[model samples]
Target: MNLSWQTRAQSIAQMKAETFDILIIGGGITGAGLALDAAARGLKTALIEKRDFAAGTSSRSTKLIHGGLRYLEHYDFALVREGLRERTELLTLAPHLDDPLEFVIPIYADKRRNYDHPLLVRAGLFLYDLLAGKYNIGRHRRISQAEALQLAPQLDPRGLKGALVYYDGRTNDSRLVIEIIKTANERGAAIANYVRLVSFRKDVNGKVCGAQVTDELTRESFNVNARAVINATGVWMNEVRSLSADLSDDDKQLRPSKGIHLTVSAERLNVTTAWLIPAIGEKRFYFVVPWEGRVNIGTTDTDYHGDKDAPGAVQSEVTNILQAVNAYFPSAHLEPSDVISAWAGLRPLISSGNTKQATTAVSRKEEIFTDRDGLISLAGGKLTTYRLMAERGIDLAVEQLRDHFGVQAKPVSTKQIILSGGGIKRVDLEAHAHKIARAENVSIETARHLLHNYGTNAEHILALTHEDEALKQPLLADLPNIAAEVIYAVRAESALTIADVLTRRTRIAMLGAAMNCVEKVADLMARELGWSEEKKAQQIAAFRAEYEREYLIAR
Candidate 1:
């Protein structure tokens, strides 16, 4: 059930003739989750994305599957409970992707922070552990100043008393989203990337029925009819909503906030544990999490009133992160040059003006909107709670179906249904995978990497190598990626462009590489994808242009 160009063309052909039970507009985690839920519930489902899966904010997350310790500061008990519960569920579902990560928050007796900060933080951690009762990995503990310094000697010793060590989950957000799409495909949902929803379709009664979609790659237009059309475009919800005819000003929903993150080389700050610094200006604070062998420092929560598609990190936001981390780790002495990458994500929050004066004040809770014409839009939720959001969304759609078509849908069964790699539940999967690889006549290192990425489905990847030895060779000399992976992505994952193959299908963009290695990998992918010489040149130019825009350009 791998989604390919042929599958996409078939879906378009079917959409032109008949109506689907459910047509999901955004192919992100939420949209993909909704499609899986609907299809699992016996509904004919279809999902479309204008770009690659997770091309938007889902891929740009802080890459944490945590209970959000800072939410406790605002006394958000319910949000904390929901996030903690979802965090544990994700860890259980994807152990290979979501691993235990410890964070150390220094209890500094600074003039800025109240002297009773340690007690406050301890209370918060206690509540966090309690919320994650059965799912708790480890309890929070306080370490002495000497012990804390031993853990991270690079810290500034001025007024450093002790620190709190608590456990949470870290994950590769893009990989998780890709797995979700894979799981949806396994459940019989038709998915197409690089397809844009250009217009909306309505029935004779003027009720919302379907969408006129265009394949961005081929510039071919087709119409899809469905019992319900759901717009799950995160920050672009409003843009999609405008396509509906019967929507009014009152139904206009969504207030998006941009959060920026800066990536510094791990060598810049050689610490083992992640950090939660009480940064100035913000009501609570921000975090400096260590992820993927790099120091990921981020997240400035400010209103972004700019273009949603291409939001750039401002100079002030970068300065705020550098200044805060510098206050504690003065010895790291980080500067702009140490940054390998910088990214920004927009959080699509529902604005309830009476309750929330600012976007950050609004709950990250999911909201669903259905006009009189039945144009449904879902917005405002974190990646951790995507499944829960989907459950709610599908239930709402089913109710709409009963009213409109006099049909009743079956109950959702995704709660017990595991995802792609999550289907197998084993204790020592690492050792077991090695044995399987030996039987398949592949290298142990290659086997381990495949298992980490595809779980039991690693067999499929290796089988390709066994069939064609040339496919097993690494794509680039410096990278660990296999040449077969590029073909796999195009044939199975709907990677229409070189950027989709390099950036999302494989992590060539995120993985720090030498300048030549980056260009070489891009060129390799271009060749494998059968791009023309001019196209290959264009891709290299585009990759370099993006690099300069993100890293090299001076503020």
Candidate 2:
């Protein structure tokens, strides 16, 4: 069951022939998690995505698996506790993708803002550690201002009261989603990308029993019958929910806000640990996270009312983020030229009655609502708690299945079921990576990168290099990724388009070499997938246009 275009026809045929126990819509982290949980329970499950997996919000996250330390101020203890628990599970399940990282919250003597006080910040860290309990990666510690400056020399020293250090997890956001989808597929779930949900298919009694889906690539239409349907289309939840017969315009639930991040060279920021600094004037804080050998400074949250498909980061948003980072690290005067790339994603924040509240103040809790037609919709949850959210969604789905379809399924055991490439112990991962590095005749850094991203699956790509020595060549100079990854993506990872491989699968696009290597990568893909010259050119053009629109913000 390859996820690539090679098996698309077979996947569609199977979808039309079988009546799935559960049909999931949306291919983001939420939908991926739900599919994994539902399929793990021995239920006949199928998932359809209008775009490539994680093409939207899932791929454009801040790339942290944190427990939302800032939420402590709101007294949302339950949400924080749940997130910490999930963080622990993810670290164990996908050691290669997720790892523990240290974060430093620099305190300031800002008497005007009570929350910025050193004592209060220390108390918050204590509460954060307490919430993690046994799952705590590292206990929170307080350091003197001198010690803080030694850690982050670029930090603004004036009025710096002290700092608190804590531990959180970080991950490759897009890879995590892809692995989850792959795990679900491995468990007898029929999953297809570029298969858009055209409309909801209801039975004679006006009850939704399946979905009318269309293949976005081939433009072929088909019906997939199922016992229950789920609408997990994150920010576009209302659009999908309205497809149901009973849901109306008044049933709108999502209050999406745009969060944007900028990628800059790590040497420019000169910080090894993550920094949680207060965003200039906002009540919320912004992070200067270290990821993929770069400094990821971001996340400006503001109400967005624009195109949901491509939420481009405006110049103002970029400027605001730059200002926040500069405020913390005054020595690092990062201008627009320093920005390697920028990306924006919508947070499917659940709406509250008080419209005046800041987007940051909005709750990040998950809510599952089932309509009269048995269409289940989920919205407004952070990435860290996705598995828990899935368990809850599947529980509700199982209840509906028993009531309507008389199907009995086993309870979810996702916590115990390790994800793909998760069998190796964390302690042994380094030695295993070293062996692969020696066999592949590549640098230890390159081998470790592959191991970190693909875990045990990295050996498959290494084997391809042995079959063809050319596969060991890098896509571009100075990049560690080998050519075999591109081929592996098409043959095994369901990557159909140049954008899919560059942006999500391998992340060459976000690393500031997308335009430079698009033609070469497209040619490679064309050779493997048998794309015509015109189609190859079209794919390259499309990737270039998207990169310019999303990453190259006008100064």
* Total clashing pairs for each candidate: 0, 0
Task: In angstroms, give how far residue 110 of model 1 lies from its true place.
Answer: 1.8
In the range 390-426, model 2's lDDT, one tens digit per residue, is 9999999999899877999986689987887777777
Off by over 4 Å in 1: 111-116, 245-248, 251-253, 280-282, 354-356, 424-449, 468-479, 514-528, 546-554
Model 1, span 1-555: residue lDDT tens: 776667767776776787788999987888988988898888888998987799888887888887787677668778778877888887777766776788887887774642235777789889999988887878999998898899788888888888899988787787788888887877877788888999988889888888888988789888888989898999998878777753365644577788888877778887778777767543545677876556788787767778776676767777778888887788998887677677788999777544347666777767887877888889887888888889889989999888878777777667676777765554667786779667866566666666666666666666777778877876655555676676677677666666676667666565544344555555556655677778777877776666555433137
How do all models score by TM-score? 0.91, 0.97
State the lDDT at 437 in candidate 1.
Answer: 64
- List where candidate 2 sits over 4 angstroms from the true fold: 109-115, 246-252
Best of the candidates, TM-score: 2
lDDT of each: 0.76, 0.86
